[model samples]
Target: MSLMDYTDQWLSVVQPQISQGSSWLADLRQGAVEQFATQGLPHARLENWKYTDVKALAKREFVLPKNAATQADALVAETSLALDGIRLVFVNGLFSAAHSQLDALPKGANVLPLADNANVAKTLLGQVAAANFSGFTALNLAAWQDGVVIDLAANTVVEMPIYLQFVSTEHTDACLIQPRILIKAGVYAQATVVEHFAGAEEAANFTNVVTEVDLADGAQITHYKLQQESVHQYHIASLHVQQQRDSRFTSHNICLGGKLARQDIQVELNAEGAEVNLNGLYLGNGRQHLDNHTLVNHNAPHTNSNEDYKGILNDRSRGVFNGRVVVHKNAQKIEAHQSNGNLLLSDKAEIDTKPELEIYADDVKCSHGSTTGQLDENALFALRSRGLDEAMARGLLTLAFANEVIDRIEIPAVHDRIELAVAGRLPEKFNLKGLV
Candidate 1:
């Protein structure tokens, strides 16, 4: 059957569940699903999705997760960062108060489940504009049941980071889960957030997530995402961010698992002096496929944006990176730079990277470039001459190539976690601990 047919079937089955909400929300959901019906899953025919096709996602019959509760404590412990902070846990896309720490938040900080605060959440939901998003985004908007909301008061500085954990359990039948997150930073406020997606080792599931962030004037936020789903799972996520005058936003994305995974990040600088920085790392082995796409809009004068993404592909794994930066008219004095670099460890591994810059303002300084190649033979030879074996030398070089992006992570625990995960993906013959 065609993807549209599959989508229609699923929508029909979930219509009842989607209808069990406030009238306003129900109307919003209906509108979003209607939009999805008009535009099915993005295909290779679409320019933005030309490399990573979503048609394969329709082959599997995925049903909404059953209400049956799964033991998530063990899973959370295994994936824990061990950082001291407020932790919000979601099991199979439903909020788990038993595992979450929501009490005694910093003064002026408000945290709650979106379902519990629908009246307030409604005002913030779908506020950020994502004109080029695909049908998955609409599906997520229509189907998401519960998620987290964070709001910070003006001038508040949250020293401790916030951790949002999502765990998917292994089910007998393939299932689907959609989680949404909304974060609003008040003027002059500063905060950090970490989003973690994990699942059982061999679960066949599909996870669709959407996150919206709004940063007011002088606000700053550091966001991080770590995707470590099962090799049999499919994961797709979208992040939309809007920045006001003199605001700053940073994102660090680390993708370590999933048979097929894709993430889209879009940011808009809506006022002068707004700044954004995006860094990402994805490692794929076996038959895995990972794709990262990003777009930044420089809509105001004196705004700046920097983006760098790196990929490591081994075995027959495939990777894709597409980044675009647009400088709008009258948005002069903008400085934007984008770079995507890839390292192929095996001859069969493949990578496709494209960096695009559309400049309408002549005074803006915008540049983008992409590079994909195997390990440097000269560096490998030098390492071998230093008494290191071929495998060890290659492992060290590969780790170094990936570290250029990891080292940019400011959080020590996050940096360590990413380092460990990358080391585990290397060949067993190479001892990467010492090199890191």
Candidate 2:
């Protein structure tokens, strides 16, 4: 129970309600509670948290909820996963503005609601995530309870897609839902941001989130993440990106629910002709535990990066993918690619895939790969000679191997709500996408 008594019972109940109106946000929340009492919670003796273990979720007994004990069905369990632009609602972690809708914001867009604009992100808020980046980003910058301060202006183009909905309920005590998101994209601006995390199915809540994105020069950003909470919730998230020159960043991560889910994606292209794309998909059945950790740093010089991640596991579920790509040193003519693929379909399902490439540039074009198999026993007996049974031929080849990361989701209602939440986490869900 010690990380200095979990940072003194989390700053004696979140420092008098969100560090009272800024003194540089009370020194950035007391320097992230003294760096979570000097790097404490993040177990598996950390090698990038070696195969994800949170030591029984850092020995439970947690708290830091500062009001949001809401639940008269929490607006029918968060509008059954609603989506239709510019919507921001957070039930368990404050900020609801009666289930928000910001009147289609524009005209010098600055999507506030970080409880009084969080001092307008005092110089890019913690300058792209570094309050000792871990131990849950120092307990989400030491206990955050509300967020969303996106300031895009330069050549502002919003065209919808700013939805951050986080809802959790049923907490008798053992709460912790931290949300801190700050996005700043100006020069040549364009945006898309969607993050949906749900809970309340016997909510054993704990969602620690941190998102910081700043891309200026030639700016363009698209990030979508959906982590379906409450398999007995506990989800950890982190996405930190900083890019420049010709900047363009894209990421789509869909990890269905969590008994224990982890996502840490860090991208730094720096300048030159920055470009980054990362697409991921993780689905697991009972005994669920999904982990995805990605790091891409080209550091300039005609930089371009692309990564793809996919995983599908059934019962006895376990999946982890660690993808890394580094091309620094002059970064000469850089181009990096990484891929991790897994499909285990229960033979006591399990996957621990890793794809890494570190090239100290020499006119670089780096590549990384990892693959795990199952299905395709001659295309599942050729779809059982075309009559299509055998659980609809392994759910149409596991939804065509998860439609290769859901056919690069280009927002058709966030791609049919991620193809019906990855076909309702397939365990033979019939008409999986209704006969395609």
Candidate 3:
């Protein structure tokens, strides 16, 4: 059957859950599905998807996760790593109210499921996301199960952080899941949020995610994403952040999972004096692959943006990084910098780094740099001479190479968690011993 036939069947499976469906949303989904039908998954011929193959995803037969016959208490009890704030939980791409905890929300903080909040989800759904996202994204918009909506009131500062944990289970075999999240920060508001994606085991699964963030004037937001899934799974995520005047937005993406994964992130500075920082790290081993494509747009004058992404490739794995910074003609005095650096451990492993800068404004300052190579032999030699084993020496150097980007993360707890996760991925490379 064609891809649209599968989407239609998928919609029929979830038809019972459509509660008070907005007419506009229904029509939007219908159109998006039709668009998806006309054009199947983008092939290598497509400019944007020239590297990754979407046909591999189109060949799979995926089913929606049935309702949990298992007790939810088992799921809630497993979330033992307690953080100091509200928590939203989703299982198999379905939001679980019974599993969420919101006891410490401040006076003006509002948290609700996006699917239930139809009007709000519709207002924000396709508004800021990439218009021509991949086929998986189109499928997500056409038949998304549930999402999260977070709204912070003006002049309010949420003392505690908000944690979002998405768990993928129930599909013992191959399946597809999509989770969507929309966040709005009112004027003069401040908040921090953490999003984590994890899988149950090494199963053939796919996660297609889209997140939209809107920040008003003078607002500040710090957002981080942690990805760790089974090696047999695949993950694709897109994050679109829009900032108003005098707003500060800091975002970090940590990728440490999936057999074949790709992330597309974009940040737009819409008003004057807005500042943004984007940082990312991806660790790959075995035969896995990780790709990150990011774009930063300076639309107004006096806006600043800085970005740095690092990757460590080992074994036979491969990694790709593409970062772009654009300065509009009207955006005078805009300053932007972007850099991508990668370290390859094995001769068989490969990495491609491309940092691009496009400027239309005469008064803007922008630069981009990219580098791909192996670990420094001089540093490894120094460490090995100090009574360290070959594997230990390589691990130390790899850790230090990745630590430069990790140190940029301002949050202590989040930084620590990411560092520990990266450390777990490295092992001693015997081949580099004498060369180092």
Candidate 4:
């Protein structure tokens, strides 16, 4: 059957439980479901999904939660990822204040659920909750129960990092979860936020997530996303960012989960002297697949951006990276660079890297490059001669290859934690001595 048929079938299956959401949101969800049914999942024929096949992943039917009270302990327990920082917890896409802690927040920083602060956040939330996004986003807008909203007052510098976590625990059946997040950084403010998406068990599940970030003039915000889900599940995520004049923004995405995962990140520079850095890494094995698509827009003069993304594919896994930079006609003196590198550990594995540059300005400097190849034999032999075994040598070289992307991260603690997680995903027998 076609993808549209599959979407209709699943929507019909969940139609009975649509009323479980808040009564005020029931109509919105219904409208979103209808839009999703009409739009369906993007396929290889679509321009945006040409390299990634999302139709196959959309064939399965996921049960919606019966209520919000189930799996309360799991959500509360997982909220400790940020011990000294503000924390927001979402369980199966339902916000839980009881499990969240924000008492240590800075004087001017505010952390609250979108549904709770509905009066103030509702305006911006509605403005950003656009329906023109992908089918997954449309579905999320319709059914998302509640999500975290953060606001930083002018000139406030939040010392402790804020962490937001979306934890999914399979109850007695397979299910789907949708999460939405909104962040606003005031003028001249500075802060960092980390988002982690995880599943408690390996089960048939799906998660659709959307995040929006707005930074005013001279504001600086660093954002990171870590994706680790059940191997049998599907994950689709999109992040949109807007920067005002002289502001700075950076986003780091780490993908290490799901049978099929796709992420799209976009950043728009609206003022002169605006700067941005986009970095990402993905690891895949078995028959897993991961894809990253990033776009950087230079709409104003004197804006600058740098992007680097890498992936390591072992076994029969596949990886894809598409990085695009666009400089408008009036965006003179813009400096932009992009690069994508990949290592295929096995002949059966595949990596597709594409870098595109579209510049309409005469005085702009833009460049992009991509490379895909196997492990270096010379380095492998050198490590083996130094008494390291084959797996150990391979692991060391792999970690070092990913280190180039890791070095771009500014936070020390986060850098270390991400490195450790990536190392653990390598071959079990592999060892590391001089790799660090």
lDDT of model 1 at position 370: 86
* TM-score, per-candidate, Cα-based: 0.96, 0.34, 0.90, 0.90
Model 2 C-alpha lDDT per residue in residues 1-436, reported as the tens digit of each score: 5334455555565565556557887777777877877776766767888888886776676676656634524543453455665888787777877677888977767897786787777777778988787877876786686788899989998988888887777778857888889999999999898888876778787888889999999999999988888788889999999999998999999998889999999999899998999999999889989999989888888989999999998889898999888888998998888888888877998988878788887997777778787777998998889888878788888878888888888877767767877886787554665654
Regarding TM-score, does 2 or 4 come out ahead?
4
Q: What is the lDDT for 55 in model 3?
A: 57
lDDT order, best first, reads: 1, 2, 4, 3
Model 4 has how many clashing residue pairs?
Answer: 0
Per-residue lDDT of candidate 4, residues 323-417 (tens digit):
98999989999999998899887789898888889999999888889888657899999989999888988888889889888877777777886
Question: At residue 234, what lDDT does model 1 achieve?
Answer: 94
Tens-place lDDT digits, model 3, residues 322-381: 888889988999999888888888888888777888899999888788888667898888
Which regions of candidate 4 deviate over 4 angstroms?
A: 7-37, 66-83, 126-129, 374-382, 432-436
Which of 1 and 2 is ahead in TM-score?
Answer: 1
Q: In model 3, where do residues sit more than 4 Å from their true spots?
A: 1-20, 69-81, 428-436
Q: lDDT of candidate 4? A: 0.79
Question: Where does candidate 1 stray beyond 4 Å?
Answer: 67-70, 129-132, 376-382, 433-436
What is the Cα-based lDDT of residue 360 in candidate 3? 91
By lDDT, the better pick of 1 and 2 is: 1
Best by lDDT: 1
Full-model lDDT for every candidate: 0.87, 0.81, 0.78, 0.79
**Worst 10-residue lDDT window, candidate 2:** 69-78
